[model samples]
Target chain A: MSELVHPLHRFIRPSVKYSTFCPGCGDGTVTQAILRAIDGLGMNLDDFVFVSGIGCAAWIPSPFFNADVLHTTHGRPIAFAFGIKMGLPDKKVMVVSGDGDLVAIGGNHLIQNARRNIEMVVLCINNGIYGMTGGQAAPTTPMGIRTTTTPYGTVENIFNISRLVMAAGASFVACWTAAHPKQLTNSIKKAIQKKGFAFIEVFSQCPIQFGRKTGVGSAVQMLEDYKKRSISPKEAAKLSEEELKDRIVVGELVDLEKPEMLEEVKKMKNKARGEVE
Target chain B: MNGKRVQTGRYFMMGNVACAEGALAAGCEFSAGYPITPATEVANRLAERLPQVGGAFFQMEDEISAIAAVVGASWAGKKSMTVTSGPGISLMLENIGFAIGVETPCVIVNVQRGAPTTGMPTVGVQGDMVQAKRGSHGDYEIIALCPSSPQEMFDHTVIAFNYAERYRTPVFILSDAFVGHMREEVVIPEPEKIKTEYRKIPEPGTDPQKIKGFLDEDVAPMPIFGRGFKAHVTSSCHDEYGKRNLIDISALDNFIRKLSNKILKHKEEITLIERDYEGAEIVLVSYGAVARAAAMAAAQGRKEGIPVGTLRLITVWPFPGEEIEKMARGAKHVIVLENNLGQIYPYIKAEAAHDAEVSFLPPRLVGEIQDPEDILRKIREVSK
Candidate 1:
């Protein structure tokens, strides 16, 4: 068993001999799905730069991936990735961060990047709570759910991340869970191929920190819940809003073509320099 | 230095505009900033200039994202900068510490205003002197410069970028509202005459990931992303290979010591001062806008048969302790004048106490520059 090799071993850093993910954590599945997407793209590893903010999901790419990874401060991966994309417009920049890191403190960056339609792929791993910090309520944590900070239950309404990005004018947006690995991988692939502000929020599980408190005590149970509650956008449209309140509407929410920010900046610069009419 | 030089000429330019021009001359290709009073002009200038020069400028969502983007752009292989005021600097502290931790080279311009939280927007103050050095959490040294006039604002900005690139740390141009907003004849040097130094890049094809000791005493060459150097950069304590090492005390100690000592070890090269200590009984210690007042007062004191000299600090951090101590020893009194409630006076007092008596003239009001007559009065008072 020790000699047995994982197929994704080529992409993993040999120095980090063990995974930091907890047993039954869905972060591993998400990581594998992203790796599979990159592999399927037939892109050179050097051509990709993986940027992340602080969290369990942030750790997914930091020391684990063989590609150039920038592990930045919490809640600022999109901003950091913005810099990277602006500096090297040719390289494919991807941001992998957690829901708390994105929708909470970094929510401004998320919406602003969407508004500008900057070219990058953002993988927001939504585990419903702050898994690394012991299940604190996050912006995405459903209302009435019990968390470390909200012992009685959360009072605030949850952020509909897909709708938020869609409203902000992202070129591509989608939501999928680890239960739908194949579809998640495909969405990631399409996002990478997309040219402007691609955001994919992957629903992941935190059995130890979030599941036990939320009544889904095991990873398998959480996956079952996701499968049971998940619905496609078309299917969700058929159901009443009240009936779809607890359901996860999965699949591409928006896909459109727009002028990317960097290209516009280049054109603006050329016009300013009198090199273009 | 590697780029083609633009034509040079004299222009009646505001200090903030000169600062933007200096950045352009020094090869800064990326800037991200959030507008605040006084410093807004710097952003405005960059917004207009960067596009003409084929560089990128972003008005970030806020100060935090502004500096964070600058750090990111620096890692992506561009000379980057950001301009802000006290409030913005306060917001950028966390990421500034991140820049220090990763040893990323960038420049920050703080056109200081009255502080403690939105004190006076239009008024210039030198209150952020100590904050510029110690604002970010952690044990690290930074390079900070203060410019007294529009010309120096332009000159020091170029020096700030050069030092930031040479040291691989965030260098600050600590101009005040007075200098940032004031207009003067700034002689723009031909690009060839403007000397700039960039960070040393690793030899092509060398795997930066395989190399260790990036923060060694000698300082490792920077290997930016997308250049085939697959390096992992983090804000946490890390080993030589850029891998996270949270528990190892020795590695942490080595990294921290090097991060600080790289500046301390080259204090002579980093420290810049203008001094006239000959036959001086009183010395006026000053920086930024207040330095102009002190210089005029010192000249007046000399004309009035008092032996008054001045020590103008160009580089404020890695504080010119040795120069201050030597100057203090030869003088009977050292008077520190600034547009704040004695922020840097304590450092001067600490360095000059045993050798000479130190006096402070804090800001008279929120936006007031120290009157030359007031500084002259202090010089006369101390001399008597």
Candidate 2:
């Protein structure tokens, strides 16, 4: 008989003993899904560089990943990823940040990078509320949800982050929840293999800040809700817009070929150097 | 023309274009910026020049992202830069602080325009002088260079990059519209003649656990990305190994002191001053475009037999107090000149006031260069 070790243990830094996430938080599940995806693809952490911004989901990479990690200012990870990708065009650059980070303050960088079609994988962990700042209302928070900042209930409409990235010209777009870790991991694998700006919006549960305080119930209850509300894009295609309003549309929305930014830049450089017409 | 890294010939070039050429000669591999008046020419030149040299320039959405990208590129083991004006610098302050906190080596060019808030886009002013030093929140030291002419714009930009790389901090090229757009003869030296520096990085196979990548008084080897260093870079207070230590009061103190000390410890090598104040009773002190006028005034004052000399601050931050004190001790009266209403005067006085009487000579009006005749008159009055 041999002692068993966690297969995904090698991906984490030797110095990091525990994750900073709260108990049963979906961010941990998402972390496992990401590490599983990287491991499943037979790629080591050495070839990848992880970038994150300020928030709970941002903590998913820094100090945890045994790779080069850049934990940047709030809402600026994607912008920083642009430079990292440009500098090391062959190396895989990934950004893991939250909904408020990638959508609200960092929306311009997201839209612009997607439009440029730069090669990077952006994992936008959407937990509906600002968990790090004590359950403040976020841009992805559904209307009428009571958060710390929205005591009277949020009056603003929530951002459809997948649709936003899709419209911004991302080459790959997908949505999944923590409840579907297998599918989420599969999408991460696909995103890593894709060429241009790939975005995955993971609907994660914040059991502490976004759970009982907001009436979303316990961690188990939130997972059940996510499992029940998630509908496949194919299945949702058969429903009317009114009937599908409450359903979370899951799966790949767009994945196809396009001229990526760095590839075009290479050609442009050659043209400028008079090496090619 | 596109493939050439240095146009090694003398040409009457605009100060902004000279700066771009200087960056190329300094081996800047990545450039990112947004277009703004007076500074756009630097971006335009770089946009056209960088690609030919197997480098790239990105025109980001805003100044915030522009500086952020430069910092990221620097961590990716490339010498990077960003150019902008005063309003843009305001947008970049937070990320600039991030660069300082993480010890990222990058150059920032502020082709300054008149401002409180977009005050004048085309006119030159030195209003952002102190901003380059103290605009970011917190207590930290910075390195800044003031280039007064098109030639110095080219020369100082190279020096800026060297200081940034050597010190592992953001170095500012503080130019104004008068200097940035001024057309003058700029000599681009052969590539071999230019001295450029690259930041030291840890040996390729050094144990990741043993790598002390940050907070060394003598400047630690940068554990830049993509080299198996597995560096963990964050703005939060940390120890020498780049580990985040948010809980300790002593750790925060070390984080702040060690970063500032990294540059301050090298003050002798970092400070640059041009002095001709020997045997003079009244000395005119200035920097940037205003220094050109100060030089002319001092020269004219000497012709009239008044004992007047000039001390031009080439390296403006770490504040150059020692140089100022030395200059003041030799002179009875010190007059500080600036295009704006005395942005650096208080700092100058703090250093010089104990030795000599210090006075600020603002332009007759903001955005106007001090007339050489008016400066001479002031010199004569002060000497009397």
TM-score of 1: 0.97
Against the true structure, what is each candidate's TM-score? 0.97, 0.99
Best by lDDT: 2
lDDT of 2 by residue, A1-277 (tens): 8989798988888989877998889998999999999999999898899999999999999888999999999899998988888888888999999999999999999999999999999999998999988999998888898989999999997788999999999999999999999999999999999999999999999889988788888899999999999999899999998897777999998997998999999988888788522
For model 2, residues B1-384, the per-residue Cα lDDT tens digits are 637787798899999999999999999999999999979999999998898888989999999999999999999999999999999999999999999999999999999998999889999999998999899999999999999999998999999999999989999999999999999999999889999999999998999999999999899999999999999999988899999999999999999999999989999899999999999999999998998899999999999999999999998998889899989998899999999888889999999999899998888989999999999889878776
| Model 2: per-residue Cα lDDT at residue A237 | 91
For B1-384, candidate 1 gives per-residue lDDT tens digits of 122224278889899988988888888999999979979888987887777777878999999999999999999989999999999999999999999888889999999987779888888878788888898887889999999889988899899999999888899999988999999999988777889998987888885556662686667788788887788888878877888988889988988898898889988998999987688989888888888888888899999999999998989898988889999989898888878788788888999989998888875674688888888888788778
- Model 2 alpha-carbon miss at residue A94, Å: 0.6
Best by TM-score: 2
Q: Least accurate stretch of 10 residues (summed lDDT) in model 2 chain B?
A: B1-10
After best superposition, candidate 2 residue B153: deviation in angstroms? Answer: 1.1
